[model samples]
Target chain A: MKQRTRFSRTVVGGAALSLMLSLSGCGAGSDAADGDTIHVLVYGDAANKVEKELVATFNETSKVKAVLDTIPGADYQAKLQTIINSKQAPDVFFNWGGGSIKPFVDAGLLLPLDPFIAKDPGLKAKFLPSVFNSAVVDGTSYGIPMRGTQPVLLFNNGKVLKDAGVEPPETWGDLLAAVEALKADGVTPIALGGGDRWPTLMWFEYLYDRIAGPELFRKALDGDREAWASPDSRKALGKIKELVDAGAFGTNYDSVKFTDQGSPTLLATGKAAFELMGSWEYSTQQDAHPDFAKSDLGYSAFPSVEGGKGDRANLVGNTNNFYSVLKKTKHPQAVAEFLKLMYSDQFVKAQLGIGNLPTTTNTERFLDTAASPEFAKFQYDMVKAAPAFQLSWDQAYPQSAATPMYQALQQFFNGSMDEDAFIEAMRALPAS
Target chain B: MTRTATPSAADGTFDKADSPGIGAGRPGFLWAAPAAVFFALFAIVPLIMVAVLSFARWDGLSSPEFAGLDNWKLLFDDPVMIKSLWLSVLLTVLGVLVQTPLSILLGVWAAGHQRNRAVLSAIYFVPMLLSVAAVSVLWRAVLDPNFGVPAQATWLFGDGNLFGTQAGAIGVLVFVSTWQFTPLHTLIYQGAARAVPQVLYQAAQIDGAGTVRQFVHITLPQLRNSIITSMILMVVGGLTTFDTVLILTQGGPGSDTTISAYYMYQKAFKSFDYGSASAIALLLVLVSTLISLIVVRLSGYDKMRSTMEGL
Candidate 1:
């Protein structure tokens, strides 16, 4: 039996295979970084409006135009890491500084801002020194403070506190007392978004700083394992365990999330009396429950511990968001000009107008022009007066340490892990 | 005049050219080439990359350096990894146990031509219509301990902290998946049940068999092939379940609901431990493939005997 020739079919099949292979290659490809405009990628949110305005303001006079790109807040970090080394990497990008930029710094993907600082001293002199220092990896400046400082604060619903006859806690004893009063009044003493997990980390950050001072944490973050097992660490964990046992956060906290406004809504509806959160809670409240924000939202520094080593004036949270440059950017001069806008009067006013407390030295001058001058002054003064402002433990650690750390935090809060295990987890984190 | 010799292409595709008149209608290898090519590009190539990455110490940044078997070694020694594997197996087993009987019953009931049955079946299928992510989000909002249905129905939810403990988180994960996936499996069984000849039921009735007896003696035996198909799907789906766990519990209240799939994601994206994540991925592939092969073998599913061959 003679078989018919099938060479034509084989060729067609090969052609189809190659065609699809090329198509799939296109799917994996990215846009070439050859544009005249410098792309400034930022964390997208209500904050994008200010970034857009800044980019537009920069484009008015600069020869190399500026373009604003934003990845939504939840996805910004993961997406940035995926694109940072690719052709699609932005010319300048927003970051939380510290370990957020450390990976990129180690990879040599970030451009040090020292040259720009050398040419224009105001670029370094303008922003708060502490905020600027956050982006300095190994004493080389790699970032410029762009937006605002977010110090952890004890926020409350004024009506709930009044109804319960409870004051915002001024000391650990007072906070414990307030928790009892709030619990008796049938309002959750603290609205914790344990499901979101990072909110749980906030409690740990403040408690550790309050009990042991920022030095212990700074030591621990610098790869000193002994710091996590120190007496102060256990004391902080003991205090957290005390508060949790006293039902400060209530029973259903693990099911609540900040991203969905679960815990904030608890405060808004007076179901909860307090939420210890970042300065951004002000903006969050104002956006979600305008009536509550207008009349009943109250803020104060985290309560002090009576015999604690830490000073009451010490703060812990994100110092500020920063704009870090890419080493591969062809338009360094243009990028520097755009970063200059970060410290400009227009930038401060726009930031203040949106309720973000810019960390610029000139931020004090624009305080009166703020959306809520009173609120802005409260944050600005606290930031200025803080003896030491520790960055959040998650942001302070390298990116790889985040999950295990968050898991540890959540486990400790939920009674899944004891203090020892929590300490061991913290000790195992990649400190560099 | 009948020649049983098979005429294959040069590539040995087992062509039917020597068969009487059947060869004329047979399409060439080009017909399947596109699909083969697409699968190779999307699935096979990425799978190969994952295998290579499993042996390397790459953090998605910097050039990968060979780490030999370090990732695999760490995975074996890790308690969380071991727990995740056990959790994956438990969830898959629970899914099969819960879904098989429920879908079979629902499928048979829905096979009726009654108007209400048709309406109810359509309603049941709505959850399947929603994307897994969308369904997860919807359920999360609906089941929120404070504002969700649990708050209103206190007796049912008992403090409503469904994500607070290991048992509760796993329960939510399993329950949410069962809610979203039962309809698909039910559809499979429904079609299979419909294909079961009416004559067998009539014969059973004539023999004085009750509804239960007919279902057991006639309908179920006919549905043997579909049971295997649907079971394979459920086992694979359960093992790889990620979205429901992610959106509902986030493998949280402290890694309580950390199934292998979600654990792998946490490693890759959250922790940036790409090597370990790739190892976990390769392990998952091996496990599901092994489980499916075993299931097919045990059921004698590859024997390829038609249920209607006698008729």
Candidate 2:
């Protein structure tokens, strides 16, 4: 009985010790914020250099010191999701505005920025309306556009296109013709990073927008299952099938990835004619294949679908990265002051210098200061003129929908799932 | 980090309990209190939390709500969940089949006292030193369709499209894990082979047995203890294969290689369905534990007889 008592006592003590340990672990976040510093969490990348500079600039005059906390690489979103509601949640954090922040807003963890925008009209007026509106959750402002917009473009290797005697395609028919030419010339018609499933999603986004005028996708996202089964959706899928059967991306695209420089290398090496990628492809090319970027990198809007309901000017990609504040933050004034830097002249110049297309109205004046002024002008004009800018399907849909959506898209593209199967899969996704 | 380390949680407890312990010098429960507390803290506590979470509905952002058997019911109804479990079993079976013979042959070969064999053995041990992440990344770069070794050896790799097909992707995964992990098993077999009585080999030689017969008759029976240990490790390792799938294939061309562990990660991080993910995790823990137990029971390893006895 004495031994039993000792064992039970030890267990209680150990449980207490472990409970204390875990409690301390949970408390580590509150310790990080303390009284003076506002933790500014951002995705760690080359762009962080600019974010770091802005944080330093914020600290110069504000009574509250802004401490930059960065979570790097592919795990950024996962890390953010885990910590967003915890005591460790930052005062302000970076996000891709759209379905990305909807859950946070739904949970009431995000501070609506209407009050901030009310105090300073520039918070809303300083940025492009299209980019600004992406972060609006159910008609309430939740994000400030911090980084530039990344509208997807059809990037072509000039040398390969010329060798195939094809131009940068401006219409669906021309693109098909270019694919035939490039294939005949012994190059992959278009390099696709299908291994990274999100890149494969780009085709659907643009095609759906062009064929169904974005209304079908909007309806589908709003929980209308009929939207996916509609003729427009089937037509979009048919077009994708025709392109695949034509061997436009070759037979081995699933073996290639954009993130690992596989598809980009094919374009740079004159082995592939075209790659539909975001505006950041410019900087990516500049960094990895400067010679090719200088001499032959050409980009155009996704080709217009013939007789499509959507305007030719419709764009799809990441609209912009946003700075969203936590509702529980004590430093709303400091965070507001920090968000103001997003539209500042210094921020625009820094972003442009790094080849980012800032969406600020002041962004135009700094276009000449861009790393590639020609590229910058193209993206800016396209964005300014676009009737609709659809976010990537993976980003626009709630996070829960991403896995099955990716599976369906990949299977359909790879011949594992037929049109109806793909439609059913899309219909089954949990609507936001 | 959670991928390869998860099943080891169950494996570790059993492994320690199985290790020989007895007599006067044996530490009391008081001496083990610290380690037990640590185990409770890191392993048992978290496992209980996961078990509790498995029956709840959580998206990580919102607070968890009791969902009764909903997550389990949902898992049972999910075709992908069923497929993922099959994939995990297939990969594990393939790992055991491909790795066992190769490691045994290499192990026995290196057990010989040739000086050159020492150098070769050191070289063979290189993969054992690499983390699963590093190994997966290295192989991913090497197997890249357009730019990697597959491109350089087009005749061998056939357009370098190994990741495009189900068979090809599974082949690469099995081959890579075999390459990265066989060395450790080889080292185990080597140690066990060395412990086999030299007298048995001498007697076999006197009976005009060749090297092959000596290995089959003498070395095989002697290495039974090590075989069970190595096989258990392999079983657990294969069941929880996450990083390699994440890095190399991401369970694609279309859920073709979606092992349960990787699927659990997808449910948790990608889908934000922590409840379902926890359910999947618990299922994995159960599967790995059951498989390990079966291996022990069938192999009679739980009896813990001395291979060194009857000298």
Candidate 3:
């Protein structure tokens, strides 16, 4: 009995020790706010090097030195949400303008940049209007564009398209014809990373913009419920259903994820004819399969819908990353000075060097110096000519609405939910 | 106050006052305080917080506001929630049913093998040693409908989408869970089986009983405590399963394999709806508690305790 008691006590002690260790692994946010140092938190990725270099440059001759902190890209948003309300909140942080920052804007946690814009008119005017406008909530700008615009384009494998006897689709009808031709040639019409959910959303975003127009999304963003029930929305949903039924995305799309490079692998290997992805696919392909990227990579704007209200020149995707200020920060001026670097000529050159197409007005001249001049020029010209640029719906809506919205899209594509049900799901999404 | 046989009210209860043991009075409360505090901090406090959060509307970012029963009302009409709840219960039932018998057989087999017991035990326990994330990723690659081993094998009969269908996803989940966790139960039962005296099996063999008959009559009855312990563990693990499901299917083709815990995770992390997530958590806890209680009662754990004391 004594032995048993001792054994159980040891077991309980071990369990408690492990539990404490696991709990200790959780973030106890750092204190970078104690001195004259300003904390700048950015999403950690390949782009972190650029941010780090920039922070070092900022610290050289400033009264208030800036410190850079990074959270891994996958966990960045969740970590930010947890720490934002605490005293550990960064004075300046990275953000995607649209709905990503809306909650903070609503909570009045973010500082409005209008006064900064007033101080220097060139600050707002330097970046592309569409890119600059994404971070503006209630006519008050909350962030400055810090990175390049990411427009979703139809990325095709040239060799596969050639084998299938099809050109890169220029219109909706042409895309349908390509799909049929590609299917006949025994290729998956498109490689879609439906398992990731976000990749599948690009289809709906482009379709809605091309069919109904950007106003519908803007109305929906403004919480106009009827915007979802409109004929344009139904038409877009119908188009999605038609594509699914025709096997445009092939079977088992839901099992593949972009994060795992499953869809990209399919496209590169000629198992699939086309993929619709962001401009980043260029770098991704270049990094993974250089031969394919150098020879057979082809990209084109999304096809225009026949007799649709929206412009053929319209674009859809992430506008850019931004640096938004916290309302409670002690060093707003230092942050403003730091943000000024985002629009400088040095910033444009550095960003372009990394294959990021800066949205700064001066970026046009620096495109020739970009890592891939052709890809940079193509993306820049596309954005420049676009009459309207629709933000991705997931990013445009509040974070709370993301799961339901994705579910509705998934259900629709999978044929489990009809157009009305999809619309109802949209209507049911928590208001931004 | 009656003082015939019992102590007077001023002298407290008869047993407590009569007893001179170290834990009889002040020392008893003091001795128990640390464990009580630990329980209150880890278990009781979290439960209370979950209960309070269930009735409030808070996105993890903002402060919580009183939401009344709106979250519950939403849950009533939520198809995904209902499906997930059913799926969790189904998973738990399947886990206990399939895992118990299979692990027991493997355990008994290992126990009887004197020459190869170490090797056999090592082989059986390999899956349990692997991390759940690693196992899930390995299975995902192995079951990929396009390039997976199963997909290639299925091509012999005809092509089929393995992870595309609801039933197929559930089957895969159960199979993977069993594959990964059966080893743990095997180890548990092996220990219990070793405790049963060798003389009993010898006596059974002398009585002209077959291996099957000996196992049914001798091995199983001795493994009662281990089996009950493993069942509760397996049931709880199944009900709260998230990592494998998240990595393997992500509760998809269209939320078909979603369990309640996965839904709760989606609400809290994906949607940031802490209130709704808290509600789901509370519901999950209640379901788990009731299920555990039923298991304990049906398995006669109280009777087992009394029997142990009588021994």
**Native contacts present in each candidate (fraction):** 0.73, 0.77, 0.48
Across B1-311, the per-residue lDDT of candidate 3 in tens digits comes to: 01221222223433344554554443235434545667787899999999999999987667899999999999878999999999999988988889999999988877775887898789878999999999999988777656667556874413335566677778889999999999989988888788787888898999999988989998898888778879988988999999988898888767888899999998998788889999999999999989999998999864453112222
Model 1 per-residue lDDT tens digits across residues B138-251: 888998999999999999999999888888888888888889899998998899899898998898899999989999998899998789888988988999999888888888
Which stretches of candidate 1 lie above 4 Å from their native place?
Answer: A1-35, B1-26
Quote the chain B TM-score of every prediction.
0.91, 0.91, 0.86
**lDDT (0-100) at residue B177 of candidate 1?**
86
DockQ per candidate? 0.49, 0.43, 0.35
Worst 10 residues of 1 chain B by lDDT: B1-10
Q: Which parts of model 2 are misplaced by more than 4 Å?
A: A1-33, B1-25, B308-310
lDDT of 2 at B54: 100
Q: Is candidate 2 or candidate 3 better by DockQ?
A: 2
Better of 1 and 2 by DockQ: 1
Best by DockQ: 1
Which interface RMSD values do the candidates have, in the order shown? 4.1, 5.4, 3.7
State which candidate has the highest lDDT: 2
lDDT of 3 by residue, A276-355 (tens): 99988999999999999999999999999898888988999998999999998888888889999999888899898888
Candidate 2: lDDT of A216?
87
